[model samples]
Target: MDRIDVHQHLLPPGYRAALEANGVVAAGGRELPDWSPASAEQVMAGAGIGSAVLSISTPGTTFLSDPAQADQLARSVNDYAAELSAAAPRTFGFFATVPLPDVDAAAAEAVRALDTLHADGVVLLGNARGVYLGEEGQEALFRVLDERSAVAFVHPADLPGPAVPGVLPFAADFLLDTTRAAYLLVRNGIRQRFPNIKFVLSHGGGFVPYASHRMSLGIFTQTGRSPIEVLEELAGFYFDTALSSSAAALPTLLTFAEPGHVLYGSDWPFAPEPAVHYFDAGLAEFPGCDEATRDAIRRTNAAALFPRFGAVPAPVPEPPLLTRLRRRARTRIFRVIARAAGRR
Candidate 1:
């Protein structure tokens, strides 16, 4: 089955340089790399991935303390993504970024991003300035997404809270933030009211799969809803296989979410090795899955989320140069494997 990677990221050249100039860093304090379109294409081709939907990784637009700067940054980044998509119609697509602290600007940007730029969706942090997505003031953004039938890609961001003195922010905080945002959305009726907008949670919906029972208990004791009811609502949500590729986590996720609700993603550049390793592990562990189920997760489901991908024809017969390279590479690898097996 052809694969569609729903959760890949591209750091626009301007944005990457801006972050470095400001001394901003990602979860591990690692400086952001310039992930241009060429670099992304190379990684995708090497991994045999057909297409990737790009988004700005963490520290997105939220870093600019100045609202005007943030707004311009968002526009520039989205424009860059649009241009990249124009250049490589099949291999690239993108989620628009918004300036969160300024909701009015964000809403305006959403319209431009969706209507003008033709973005597949909008990317948002799980929490911004301690305010989760379902917060009273943030309703405007959700309303916009609902009106547009747009997808919201939720990634965890660090929030103001107690933390282990030296522990890495992503170790547990990222999952906690995602759980908090999702819980707020459920508790506040955002899903019920804004059913048109699709929410795709990163990191396998974070802690939702594990703490769902507790969440159910709380809801029952506090709001009189059953666990099954909550789980059913959650099932409507989409999840991506970023870092949650563990044997334990994948089975639990599969049991809770249908194949159609799960999409393939690689949290590229940040931890490409882990993302690639996890995808391989998931396939091996879920060997019993039917071809349709595998195909859905690998490509079809993602195509449903981002329809432009469906429009792009898959690569045709390989160019002669590529064909020759493939043959030579395959022959060399086969010979090495045969020699190693004979020695063994």
Candidate 2:
């Protein structure tokens, strides 16, 4: 299928230089790299991806302590993304950045980015300045997204609490942060209250897939809810396969999530290796899916979430002869194996 990647990132040249000049470090104190738009396009093209939805990854707009500087950087980043999308209409779409720690300013910027800039959605770090999205002070931000029916792209950010020594923080902490936010939303009734907002969780719902049994246990034993109930609610949530590209993880995600609930994503610039790895893993492991289901995850699901790519062509269909041959081969193999086992 002609794939649409919904989790790419584009860094403004000026902003990137500033990060390097200021010695700003990302998770694990790794110095930020100079991620340019050209590099992003090259990577996407090399992967044979048709289009990508760009978002600010981490150390988000609020990284600058000064609210004014934060706002300016956010605006610049959004404008740069919009400009890049214009240059290659078929190759790029963007999720606008918002400066947190100042709700009023962030709301205003959100309106402008959506209405004027035509941003596909808004990118929000899971925790901004140590505050989770559903917390009391951050309620207004959620209200804005819900009111606008915006796609809220939630990615992991460093927590405000003290870091543990000898632990590679981001590797584990990032997924845990996503899990924490998702759990908070469900427990606090945010999903039920704000049905209009569409939340897209990065990294295949971030531990939600593997730990689902425990979630079900908690509900049945303590909360009086079924796993199906939790899963159904979570089904309304969207997921992107960014870095968790394990051989087992992708298939497990397909089993847990309906095809329409998953989208293609590459947490680019920060870690392009994951993007390449996922494409390889998905292509090899998911060959059994029908074309329709494969098309949905590869491109259609993202197009539905972000209408910018609504007009992009669907994947070309496979030939009937090839399909028949594969089916026959599978049947023959099964028959041979069964006879050898004396089932025949």
Candidate 3:
């Protein structure tokens, strides 16, 4: 089917060994699914996806606290995945992993992967060692990514809080992890500032689309300025339909995300074949869009994101003039209210 899957996952042998050494037998509290290039290819064919952009899932290099080791494991994983992509140019392209909380190493690897390895993009966790994205400390990393106009694919890792006994992190906590990242990114103006870098939040941005107004209000509550001013910035983020292609979730994601920003994603092999097929079927049957829109979401949107894959240049969207005008008008009122009273 000419679909381009933008959020497919890979498990590198060396990275798996590192996880085993660290006693992390599970990722985000779920058993890791078996993955090989052959298996991946078969799954893609079954799902009717033409290409799968591979990435190492959560508990990635960030799981390793040792900066040196993190860097080493990241480089090795990237190298391996790059080799896989190189071997199967048509079926695979990889999003390079980076050693986060180690800005220099990440930047260097990013340069290598993008330049030499010909990686499609970079995958980053929403948080590393309790440091969420858009925090002051992560600014350096963001700057490097922004310089290249890189596609920054953000995946959710385990949240720092205590885990509830019954529910798995993927079932609940993962969603909040992504939402929190989106929150911090927008409130801190990172999303606004980084126009060049395209940030794709996985799992359909994990409630960001549904709870956007609340999130915007939350930002306004903290900072005096109304988040209303940058609501368009929040919508600019790309969302992937990884385990999120449903009637319930699609409405918000489609309505809230800018057109051509929602791309297809099958969270395999982490999702396993059964689960992957379930969502793939759901996407196929979802009545959210007509043939044109579905085609755009499944392939054309991603093709726009990774031009090397399909070379379909993105149709430049006209700016939201109405939103901009509303922002300008509301900014004055919010500023007056903020100045009249100190932050709550």
Candidate 4:
């Protein structure tokens, strides 16, 4: 099967320098993996990936305290990725990085990347600085994304809180981080309002599939909305099988994700070669997936999302204005409730 890996990471020279200058050597409790175009190609070839959509892993520009510095680094790395894709259009594509928490600057960079550089999409950390995706401060960025109908790949950063003793963030907290962002996106009605921007959650949507009902009930308790409606919205987000393609996780992910919403992801570099092959093998051998579904996961679904890969994107119908208004209003109420409960 021809595989298109959507959840791959690229550590550009400039980015690596930035990390070092900031005295940051680890992410999610793991040392950063080394990467180069040659190495990336070798790994992809061995893994049977025909194409890989690249993005910078966690701590994306968040480590930089200065907005200008963060924006500069984001631009440099995006340029590097664009050049690689230009060299080999079929073998490589990239998701542009943005200087988030600097909302205007981030929006500007996203536009430049999508229109000028032709990035496959943009990668967003689950939380930038301390701002989560659904927070009001992120509205401007989301508006820019919605206008372009962009694809936003949600990757996790280290938790805002201190790491527990002896436990690495990537081992477990990374999952919670993605789950939090997904919840807020649905709770704040981002998915409904920004219907055009396709959101892909990494690591099989973290704890989303497993804890969806509990989350929906939590939302229902706050907004008085139907739990079923909330659950449906939660299911609408796309999921990638990265470290989540195990026999146990695969079935839940496959069952929860809507048809065409589950995509292949290797989480390469960050996830070492052995782990990548192990999970890839698990996906290949999973009996729950038929040939058609496996094909879809490997390439077809991604092609449909990224027309640059040579498949036509299916047209999505827009929700009525009145419905959007109601949803936005309800989402606002939920936000207020969260605020009152001392959550951010």
Candidate 5:
């Protein structure tokens, strides 16, 4: 047990039922994954993950048409996560889920989660009902998050409008969705205005690290703000390497992220176990990461963010020979599937 995974997900029974009741059988173009606490623990143990900051993945509360229902579900999932973290304080931390697009309810839920539930942070979708963060009607929520200086984990939801036929949102649209939120947050001055809120962008901030300059230039041309300033603000966000830790992607993320800003993430359950191992191995094998840098990305950086997990005693070491063989075989199969899916 060494690394602190900041981007893991929790799929509580109640949460899953809610989605099913709402006719959402899938998210990001994939079927809902089976998840249980025991299964999550087993995966973490095998991967040498000391703790995981659990969060609800995308299509958050916005899936529900009724605001009251959305808020109720958010509260239920947050309570469930708090209980799990309480049961094993060293093994778990959680980001609270909030009912968004309804700003008042969102603010109240965020306040409750931070002040009462004691969540490490809140998980926010890139867009809620087509309203991206930093857009109008979202100020109250930001103010609450800012006041508490919460770690808001921004996850991507489905892209607005009908999906392109045969293309999955997770394959390419998720990146653009996250980039949209990042750009709007900078352009609308949310990052500057609410400087206390630590925004952790998921999937290595979508395409932000790679296309930042182009985005900044677009912002510069529209508003009088400097491109350099936009880039600086975008770079200020914390990035988690979930499924984005390939050799090609990792270097760009490391280059764009500031010291102590990169954190580990294994998007379990939603990301199949083999895919998790594949990306984890990719992170481990990248040549640019020296021992110290790897340590920071794996553990120290996240420990600094959630200090309670920093001192957890090491668990049993991962088994080597069998695990390596399994990882290699499964990773190859996952790579082929990912390539066919057109994921980068």
Candidate 6:
């Protein structure tokens, strides 16, 4: 079916070293998968994926305290991904990872990654340090992305609170992170304001489809926005089928998500090869998933978001004046910094 896996993870050599040295072993409560380009290719081929958008999943470089170290590691990972993309333009593309909480550095890196390296999109951890998405400090970075109409791939991270004794974080906590980020984006008006940026929620939007009305009503009351208005905003997210292509997940997602918003994702490495087969089998055998729906999930929907993969680019509407102004100011500042760095 020529599938595009939009939610794959890539662990670079330096990234792995940093995680281990920092005493990090698992993400979302499961052991990290053994990963390599060769192994990823084998898995993709088995699952019939034609291309994969790579990213670093939860517990990203934010584990490192020093902004210097985090910044360097982000660049290294993005550069490594760029090299892979250059080698095989058709098989691989990557979402650039940035160290958050340091919003300026992240904004700058977003520019370099999207404008210069041609990254497919940017991967943002659901919560950065302790600052979740749609909070005060995130404006600058989100503004840059809104300007570019970038694809913001939201991945789960370990929650800020201490883990409970029994439940795996990925199994439960990760879903909350995704839900929180999505709701907060709607609450802060970030989703409404940044009409151009396509926000992709991983793991079928993490209980969003099933609980959207619950979220929207609460948000509408809190923000004093009309219920239907808030409902549209809540429904605006793009969802990926990563660890979420089961008979259970797909039906709800297919029913709720807007047409052309659901994309294929094989949460690789973290999901391992065997797990990939299991979910792919489920998706293939989903009785409700007809050829049209299956094909849209596999490729067409993603192609709408990412034009390089064959789908026509959706026309971007003009940004409002405030967004335009913010974009211009950020771009000028970014240029000055770039020139200063080059001089050094």
Regions of model 2 farther than 4 Å from truth: 28-30, 216-228, 273-275, 287-290, 312-344
Q: What's the distance in Å from true for residue 230, model 1?
A: 2.0
List ranges where model 5 is wrong by over 4 Å.
311-344
**Candidate 4 positional error at 109, Å:** 0.8
Clashing pairs in 2: none
Query: After superposition on all CA atoms, what RMSD does each candidate show versus the true structure?
Result: 14.0, 8.9, 3.4, 6.7, 10.3, 11.9
* Model 5: ten consecutive residues of lowest lDDT: 311-320
TM-score of each: 0.85, 0.82, 0.90, 0.90, 0.89, 0.89
By TM-score, highest first, what's the ranking? 3, 4, 5, 6, 1, 2
Q: By summed lDDT, which 10 consecutive residues of candidate 6 come out lowest? A: 313-322
Q: Report the alpha-carbon TM-score of model 1 versus the true structure.
A: 0.85
Q: What is the lDDT of candidate 5?
A: 0.87
- The TM-score of candidate 5 is 0.89
Worst 10 residues of 1 by lDDT: 311-320
- Tens-digit lDDT track for model 5 on 255-277? 77666788999988789999999
RMSD of 4: 6.7
Off by over 4 Å in 4: 313-344
lDDT of 4 by residue, 106-154 (tens): 9999999999999989999999987887877678889989999999999
- What lDDT tens digits, residue by residue, belong to model 6 across residues 1-344? 37889999998887888899999888888886788899889888888999999999877779889998899989999999999989988889999998887899999999999999999989998898878988866888989999999999999888898999998898889999999999889998898788888999999999898897678668755876655566556667999998899988887787666667889998988887888889888888999777777777888888887778786745433434554575467446545544564476
- TM-score-better candidate, 3 vs 6: 3
Give the alpha-carbon lDDT of every model. 0.76, 0.73, 0.83, 0.88, 0.87, 0.84
Tens digit of per-residue lDDT, candidate 2, span 1-344: 26788777776777776565656656434446557667776777777677888887777865688899889989998998899888988788888889986887888888899889888889888778877765556667678788889998888887678878766656778888887777767656688778888888898888887776566445444565544456556655788877755566776666555437778776776665555766556654665566676667777778877666676445434434554474456446544543554432
Top candidate on lDDT is: 4
In model 3, the Cα lDDT at residue 240 comes to 97
Q: Provide the global lDDT of candidate 3 against the true structure.
A: 0.83
